[model samples]
Target: MRTREFLLQELHDLSQGIQGPFPYDDLRKMRETKRLTSHFKMLGDDDQLSADLNTYFMAIHGLASRLLTGNAEDAPTTAIHWLARGDFFAIFPMYCFLEDEWEQFPQFAHMYGSTKKMQEIVLSLLLTEDEL
Candidate 1:
């Protein structure tokens, strides 16, 4: 099993993309994301959300495997492949806040200077169908 350090490094790589900046030491985010991995693992793969989560987890796991085995291969997945899947990095603030226990997403614009698309994504995740 991959350790917490490996998981955190994956998240850091995802958020930073092309190695923009070394992520700050955020142990809380690491723990929360680990918990999320466990929770998402229980869901059926048929669900879209479940599938996306599985894809993401698998992508990171693959990257971790490559790193641990001294096989530093650069395949397309997550923020490392920023040119191909750049949106993942663009919307990374959501994960930052999710790690912070879900802040008022409406202020994502003010806080992170996020755009309409990002706001809608956050709203869709946070609000119910009736609210939308």
Candidate 2:
């Protein structure tokens, strides 16, 4: 697991990159953003989880900005709506972990570890694993 400090830092950096208020006051605020939680934050912390979630959020946030400003590229912007739903489901595993669904992710001791890695694995599982 990454340390708590690292996770906080990454989130802080992510928030800074956002054009609007970041939804999270802390990671816990994800709870109020049900779709985000369900789709993204359930895995134990790891590099993959952190990277995947960051990428996902960056994509979402960028699309949101484009939509709000009327500057979106037609194809990418059009695709956001289609991807949004699956993005939520892809994020569910990590969200579960953040919510203290410990049994849901047994490999990591805490979320502070490699969050990006964890997210990546969960995303792969959610996206590619037919049985899931």
Candidate 3:
């Protein structure tokens, strides 16, 4: 799928009690930020950074795919733990993802200013929903 489609599906899948065909507006809101695009660009252009990040993203996506395809146990927790313990430069996108949603999500504000905690919370929250 296209990146935008993936993100929109991810948001819908991860949110609890959100009834809908899908919230295109919210997806647009999240995607409109230049900050997110910048990180994606960086991930694409920097070889070393891109290699590491690709691995991380693949791991995360594997968990997500498993969750969506009937492997619920492989949730975001493992990926989150991996991120918290790995190279700090590798997790910049996740940090930006949490920062993007934190202001609008007060409960997630607890994760603010701490990258490790934020990464954990982001994974936990994403994996908390009943539906994948």
Q: Which predicted model would earn the best TM-score?
A: 2
Question: Candidate 2: deviation at residue 70, Å?
Answer: 0.8
The residue ranges of model 2 lying beyond 4 angstroms of the native Cα positions read 1-47, 73-82, 86-89, 92-95, 99-132
Task: Give candidate 1's error at residue 63 in angstroms.
Answer: 0.4
| 1-132 per-residue lDDT for model 3 (tens digits) | 235346435533543222233233433443456655565445454434334534654554455455455564646665656755543444554444434453563322222223233333345445433422
| Clash counts for the predictions, in order | 0, 38, 0
Q: Which candidate is the best by lDDT?
A: 3
Global lDDT of each model?
A: 0.37, 0.41, 0.44
Candidate 3, poorest ten consecutive residues by summed lDDT: 107-116
The TM-score between candidate 2 and the true structure equals 0.34
lDDT tens digits by residue: candidate 2, 1-132: 654445345544443443343323344444345655554444435425445545665555454444334464452633344343453335544444454442233332223233333333333322334522
1-132: candidate 1 lDDT, tens digit per residue:
645455445434443432222122232343346555554345335324323333443454455445445453453434334322333233342343243432323222222322223323322332345755
Misplaced by over 4 Å in model 1 are: 1-47, 74-79, 82-132
TM-score, structure 3 vs. true: 0.32
Q: Output the lDDT of residue 11, model 2.
A: 42
lDDT of 3 at 37: 53
Candidate 2 lDDT at 126 equals: 27
Pairs of colliding residues, candidate 1:
none
